[model samples]
Target: MSIIVQNISKSYNKAKAVEAITFEVKEGELFGLIGPDGAGKTTIFRILTTLLLANEGSAIVAGFDVIKDYKAIRDSVGYMPGKFSLYQDLSVEENLTFFATIFGTTIEENYDLIKDIYIQIEPFKTRRAGVLSGGMKQKLALCCALIHKPKVLFLDEPTTGVDPVSRKEFWEMLKRLQQKGITILVSTPYMDEAALCDRIALLQKGSILKIDSPENIIKNYDKVIYDVRTQNMHQLILDLKNYPSQYSVYAFGEYIHYIDKSAGFNPKDLAAYLEKNKHSEIEINISRPTIEDVFMDL
Candidate 1:
């Protein structure tokens, strides 16, 4: 394992942020921590990168203990925080150069490591870090983190506010990086992005719900799901929640995903039930389980 965490826990003042957390990331693998906000992903990142200490348990990164070998871990791992933490006053090139220099290396030495991503914003290299667009800033941040050519990389929600095009490009860059044997651990709130990782740990409120390959997670989902929509979405949810057959009901995109407690559920019965509730254009269809469904089920 490139990264090993065993029953790690952290607390702020009195409230616990992450509790009894444990997971591992293999060398050259892309592992994702998937969940919504306040899930303790950032807290775990801080602990693993040696920026913060855990009240209990232990963590090892790149063959070094987080507590006993923090300096070595810092030298061997690249960390891109959830929020942009680079010098905002520095230009893109200047920021990259500064990081490379501080690491006792020149940009030319690690040019190949960041060539693909840096090229995207090379024209804006002279632009101040604070003034660049969200996507450009993300690319520059990634470049700066990779400038040191570390063995392990930790990216904290790197594409949260980025555009779709840039987000796609960013994942592509990660795929390329893995080829060079750099282990990557990333966290994101978007359930859709879970599929991009080699394996993912579904996190919520500081607890891990599941950890497996994306396909395996979906395959293990035992519920028969349905995509349901009605003329009045709000009323439809209320009626469904009260329905005796409902196992779970949650909004997904333009429709609501419904799982019934009854195995022999019939669509016609649901349609009729909605009609009685004064809902129009009621639509219900069998649907596949997604990463979000897996998270919600747990």
Candidate 2:
């Protein structure tokens, strides 16, 4: 495994950020730390990258201890924090050069590694980091992080706030990097992106609810789920929740995803009830389980 975390925990004052959770990522695997904000994903990345000390437990990254081998860990890993920390005042080319210098290397040395990502932003190499678009800044940050040619890359919510097109482009870049055999550990709140990972740890409230391949996780969702649509979504949710036979009901995308407490669930019965309640254009049907559904079930 490229990253191994065992019973690691971290806390601030009295609030525990991470609680004795354990998981591993095989080398060269595109692993995702799946969770929303305050779910302890960032804390785990910090410990593995040797930025923060864990209050308890231990971790290893790239064959080095996080504590005893802190320096080596720092040297072998590229960490792109949730927030952009690159020098904003500097131009794109200058920023990359500076980071390379700090790592005792130059852009020419790793040009082949970052060429694909850099080419998209090369025309704006002279532009200051602050003036670039959200996507451009993302690419530059990735370039700097890879300038050192580290074996492992840690990206914390790299797609948040990015435009849909840019987010798609950025993920494509990650796939290319993975092909080059660099291990990636990424964290994100976007459930749709979870399907792209080889394996994921579903973190919530500082604990892991499950860890498995995206397919396995969704396949293991045993609920009798349905996609429901009606004239008024808001009122329908309230009405469904109040219904004596409803188990779980929440709006998902353009459809309301629901489950029934009644074992002998019948979609026709639900449609009839809604129709009787004056809900026109009602649409209710069974749907496949998605990563989001699995996460909610967890």
lDDT of 2 by residue, 1-298 (tens): 8988899999999999999989988999999989989999988988888889999999989999999999998899999999999999999999999999999999999999999999999999999999999999999999999999999999999999999999999999999999999999999999999999999989999999999999999887889888999889988888788777998888899998999988888888888888877888998888898988888877
Compute each candidate's TM-score over C-alphas: 0.98, 0.98
Candidate 1 lDDT over residue span 1-298, tens digit each: 9999999999999988899999989999999999999999999999999999999999999999999999999999999998988899999889988999889998999999999998889999898999999999999999988988999999999999899999999999999999999999999999999999999999998988889999999998888999999989998889999888899999999999999999788989989989988999988998999998889989
Off by over 4 Å in 1: none
Instruction: Report the number of the highest-lDDT candidate.
Output: 1
Candidate 1: 10-residue stretch with minimal lDDT: 263-272
Quantify all predictions' global Cα lDDT against the true fold. Answer: 0.93, 0.92
Task: State the displacement of the C-alpha of residue 98, model 1, in Å, after optimal TM-score superposition.
Answer: 0.7
